[model samples]
Target: MLVIGAGLAGTEAAWQVAQAGVRVRLVEMRPVRRSPAHHSGEFAELVCSNSFGALSSDRAAGLLQEELRRLGSLVIGTADQHAVPAGGALAVDRGRYSAALTAALEAHPLVTVERREQSELPGPNQITVLATGPLTADALAEQLRSFTGRDDCHFFDAASPIVEGESIDLGVAFRASRYDKGDADYINCPMDREQYLAFRTALLEAEQADLKDFEAESAHFFEGCLPIEELARRGEDTMRYGPLKPIGLWDPRWGDVNDREVRRANRAYAVVQLRQEDRDGRLWNLVGFQTNLKWGEQKRVLRLIPGLENAAFVRFGVMHRNTFLESPQLLDATLQFRQRSSLLAAGQITGTEGYAAAVAGGWLAGTNAARLARGLDPITLPPTTMVGALTHFVAEAPCGDGRGKGRFQPMPPNFGLLPDLPERIRDKRRRYGAYRDRALTDLATTLEQQGCAARTSSPHGQV
Candidate 1:
C-alpha cells in the first residue's frame, strides 16, 4: 500500500494499512518539499488551532469522536492520551502530538516512511492512497488536476486573529458564554442596537485584503467558515443571522432581566465571542471570525465591537489557497477515484473538512484498500454515522441540481447532514443523542462483522 502526504489522514491511513499486515510505503514531501500551511517536516502536523472541537457526545463532533473510537482511530486515541485541557473541547499540545505520531509511524515494522514529492500517478496496479490535504504542493497538485481533468480546484481559507488577553479592555469586554451555558472562559464584546448598526456599516465599508493574481480566478471560501467581510457584503443582517446571533446572552449590568422586559431590551444587540487559544490564558482567538481584511483595517474595524475597542492582536488572520476535487462527481464512497479503483483520495483533498472527519475517511479508505488488495469485497461505513455520511455525500449525491457552477462544497460533519431520526423529535439535544446512539451501535456491528479489533497491537490477530 502506498499513501501520499504524511498529514493527519495519510498518517492514519498508513497506520491502518500497516496494522492490517500490509507492507506500506508512506510518502511525505517535507524538509525536501513543503506546502504553504505546513512549517515542519513532522507527520500529522496540525497547522491551525489545536482544539479539535467539542468532546461531548451530544454534539456532532463529539459523536464523531465516539464513532472513531469504535473503529480504532489512531488520531483520536493519540489526541486523548496527549490532550491539553480546554474545558469540554479536545485540545492538544500541537508540537508533542505531531512528534509522537511521527515517532510511532517510524517504529512500525510494516511501514516505510519516505520523504519525496510524488508528482504524478504511480502504476495502474499499485494500491495507493492520496491524503495530501488542502495545501498540496503546486507541481503535484497540477498533476492531480490533470489526472482528474479539473480546470479549477482551489479554495481560499482564512484564519482568525489571536489577541493578547491582557491587552483586551475588560472594562468593556465581558467573560461569558452565550446564555451562560459553558464556562466563562470566552471573552465577549457586546454591542447595543446603535453600536451594532454602526459597526455593521464600518465592516461593510472596511478595506479588504485584495485577491492575489493566482487566487483571482479560483478562489472559493469554505461554507462552514466564510470570511466575515464576505458576510457583510451580502447584507446588513447576514452577520446577525450568522455569527452575531444574541439569543443565548444577557448583560447582567444592564439591570435585572427578570424584573422588566424594557430593561432586557437595553442588553446587547450583537455579540462576538473569543475562545482561549493557549494554556497560559494569554491569547484568545476570535471564534467564527475568519477574515481576509487588511491587517490594519481588520484592527480598525474589529475594534468597533464594544469590548475590543483597545484590543491588541497577537496574530493577525491570514488566508491560504487550498485545492480540492469535486468528490460527488469524481470519487466513490470509499474515496476511490471513480475511474481508478486502485487509487483512493482522503482528507481535505476528498472534500471532507475537519480533523476528525479526515481521519475517519483515512480509516475507511485504508481498510477498504487493504481488503481489496487481499482479495476481499470493499467495505462501506454505515450511513447513520457521520463518517459514513461524508462518504455517502461525496460518492452518491448528484453534483448539480441546476445550481450555478455545479460543485461539491467541502463540509464538516454536522447533524443536519446526517439522516433524520426514525421518530419526530423537536428537542435538538434529544435528537442528537439518538443520532449518536444509532451511529455507535451501527459502528460496533460493522467492526465485529469485519473481524477488526477496535485497538490492536498484534499483526496476526484479526479481532
Candidate 2:
C-alpha cells in the first residue's frame, strides 16, 4: 500500500495503514521540491499557527481532536507528547513536534518513508491513498484533475502572523476567554469604534501581495479562510461581527460587572485576539488575522491595533494558492474514488478545512485502505461520529455542477454538520455537549461493529 505526501493527512494516513498491519511506502516531495508554504521535509509540519484549537470537548475542533485521540490517532499522540501550554488549547513546540513524528515514522517496522515526488495515481492492481493536501505538486495535481473529470476548484488561503509575546503591550491588552470560560487563554487587544474604523480604512487602502503567475487567480476566498482585510472590505461591521466580535468578551479590569458595582467602562467596539503559539508562551499568533499585506504594510498597519503599537513580528501573515477536488462528483463516503475503489483521497484536497479536519479525513482513508489491502470491504463509520459526518459530508456536500448533489464549498466541523438531535437542548453549552456525547457513543459502536483496533502501535518520541 502507498500514501503520497507527508503532511498532516498523509503522515497520519500512513501511520494508520501500518498500524493496521499493512506495509506502507510514504512518499514526500520536500527537499527535492518544496511548496510555497513549506520550509522543511519534516512530516506533519505546521506552516501556520500551531494551535489545534480549544481543548474543551464541547467545541467542534476540540471534539474532533478528542475523537481522534479515542481512536488512537498517531498525529494526536505526537501532538500530546510534545504539547506546549496554550491555556485551554493544544499547541506544540513546532520543531519538537515534527521531530517526534519523523522519528516515530522512521522507526516504524511496517512503514518506509521515501523522499520523492510521485506524479501519478496508482494503477488498478495497486492500492494508493492520496493525502497531498492543498498545495499538491502540479504534475500530480493535473493527474488528479484528469481522473476526477472535474476541473479543480481554486481558492486563496491565508496564515496569521506571529509576534513575540513580550512585545505585546500588557497595559492595554488583558488575558481572558469570552465570558471567563476556561483559563484566560487569549490576549485581547481592545479597540474603540474610532480606532477600529481607522484600522479598517487603512486595511482597505493597504497594498496586497501580488499572486504568482502560475497560481490560479480566483476572486473567491473560502469563507472560512478569508483574509482579515477582505473581511474588513466586506463592510465596516463585517470584521466586528466575524473575527473581532466583542460580545461577552469584556475585560474584568475595566468592566463594572465585578462582584458588586457594575460601573466599569463598556466593552470595546472591536477586539483583536492573540493566542499563545508555543509552550513557553514566548510567541503569540494573531488569531483570525490571516492576510496578504506586504511585509512592511503588515508591520505598519497591524501595529495600529491597540496593544500592538510596539509589536515585534516573528512571522508575517501570508496568502497561498490552494486546490481542492469537487469531491461530491468523484468520492464515496469512505473517501474512495468512485471510479476506483482502491484509490482514496484525504486532507484539504477533499475540501475539509482546518488541521483536525485533515487528520479526521486521513484516519478514515487509512482505515479503508487497510481493509482493501486485506481483501475486506472498506468500512464506513456511522454518520453520528465526527469522523463519519466529515467524510460523508465531503462525499455528498452540495455541488452546483450537473455531476454533483448541490454547491460544494470547503467545510469545517461544526454542530450543523451533524444530524439534528431527537430532543433539542436550548443552552448552547449543553447542546454542544449533547452532540459530543452522542458522537462518542456512536463511534464506540461503529468501531466495535467494524472490528477495528490498533493491531500495532507506532513508536513515538523526539528524533
Candidate 3:
C-alpha cells in the first residue's frame, strides 16, 4: 500500500494500512519543498487552527472524533494525548501533537517514511491512497487535475466567522426564514436604516488581513462567495439586496403584521442572518459574511450588527487559496475513483474540511486500501454516522458536467448533511443527543459486522 503526503490524512492513512498488516510507503515533500502555510516538515501540521472543534458528542465535529476514536484513528488519538486546555473543544499542543504522530508512523515496522515529492499517480495494480491535502504542490496538483479531467480544481476559501449560539441576543434576533418558505431555520437580526448605514461604514473602513505572495497572486474571489466588505464596497444598498436583504422576513416581536401601522413602523431596512453551524444549535455562522478582514477588525465591525453586540466567535473568517477536487464527479463513497478503483483520494483535497474530517477520510481510505490489498472488499460506513455523511456528501453531491460548470464545494461536518431521523424531536439538545446516540450505535454494528475490533488504543495513551 502507498500513501502520498505526510499531513493529517496521509499519516493517518499510512498508520491504518500498517495496522491492517499491510506494508506501506508514506511519502512527504517538506524541507525538500514546503507550502507557504507550513513552518516545519512535521507530519499532521495544523495550518489554520490547533482545535479539532468542540469535544461534546452531541456536536457534529465531536461525533466524528468519537467515531474515529472507536475505529482507531492515529491522528485524533495523538491529538488527545497531547491535548491542551480548551474548555469544551479539543485543542492540542501543535508541536507536541505533530511530533508524536511523526514518531508513531516512523516507528511502525510496516510503514516506511520517504522524504521526497511524489509527482505521479501509482499504477493500476498498486493500491494507493492520495491524501495530499489542500496545499498540494503544483506538479502533483496538475497531475491530479489532468487525471481527473478537471481544470478548475481550486478555489479561494473565504469562510464566514462562526459565533456561539448562546451569545446571540435572541431579544434582538428572531428565528425566521425568508418568506417563511421553509422551517424557521435562520436567526434574523433586523437592522434599521441608521444601523445598516453605520455597519456598512465600519466594514468599508476596517483593516484587511495581508495575504501571502502566493495567495495575493491568485486572490480572485468567486462571485458567489464574495466577502461582505466587497459587497459593501460595491454600493450602499448592494448588501441590502444581497445577504442582508429584509424583504420577505418579518419579526413577530415587532407586533402583529395584520396591524398596518405596526407593520409599516417596524419594517427593517436590512437584516443579517445567522445559520445554525451545528446539530445542537450551539454554533451559528454569519450567513454570507465571508471576509478578508483582520481578526480584530472582524470582531469590531461585525459586532455593530444589532444582535451580535456580545457575540463569541468560534472561528473567524479566513480567505486563502485552497486546492480541492470536484469529488462528486470523480470519486465514490469509498473514496475510490470511478474510473480507477485502485486510486483513492482523501483529506481536504476530497472537499472534506476541518482537521477531524480529514482524519476520517484518511481512516476510511487507508482501511479500504488495505482491505483491497488483502483480497477483501472495501466497506462504506452508514450515512447516519457523521464520518459516513461527510464522505457520502463529497462523493455524491451534485456536480454539473462540462467545462466551468461544476458546483461542488468543500464542506465541514454538520448535522444538516446527515439523513433525517425517523421521528421528529423538537428540543434542539435532545435531538442532537439522539443523533449522536444513533451514529455511535450504527458505527459499532458496522464494525462488528465487518469483524473489525470494536476498540483500538485509547486516545489518552501516554505521550
Candidate 3 deviant stretches above 4 angstroms? 159-199, 205-210, 220-226, 238-289, 294-317, 399-406, 456-463
Q: Supply the global lDDT for candidate 1.
A: 0.76
Q: Give per-residue lDDT, candidate 3, residue 216.
A: 71
Q: Which pairs in model 2 have colliding backbones?
A: 85-279, 256-263, 256-264, 398-406, 398-407, 398-408, 399-406, 399-407
Query: Which TM-score value belongs to model 2?
Result: 0.67
Q: Which residue runs of candidate 1 sit more than 4 Å off their true CA positions?
A: 155-320, 401-403, 455-463
Task: Give a tens-digit lDDT track for model 1, residues 236-291.
Answer: 78887877877666656666655568446666677787776533465577776778
Name the lDDT value of residue 122 in candidate 1. Answer: 81
Each candidate's TM vs. the true structure? 0.68, 0.67, 0.78
User: Which stretches of candidate 2 lie above 4 Å from their native place?
Assistant: 150-320, 402-406, 453-463
Number of backbone-clashing residue pairs for each candidate, in the order shown: 1, 8, 0
* Candidate 3 worst ten-residue window by lDDT: 454-463
* Candidate 3 TM-score over all chains jointly: 0.78
Tens digit per residue, CA lDDT, model 2, 255-318: 4655333423577899899876543465677888888889899999999999999997756786
* lDDT of every predicted structure (CA atoms): 0.76, 0.80, 0.85
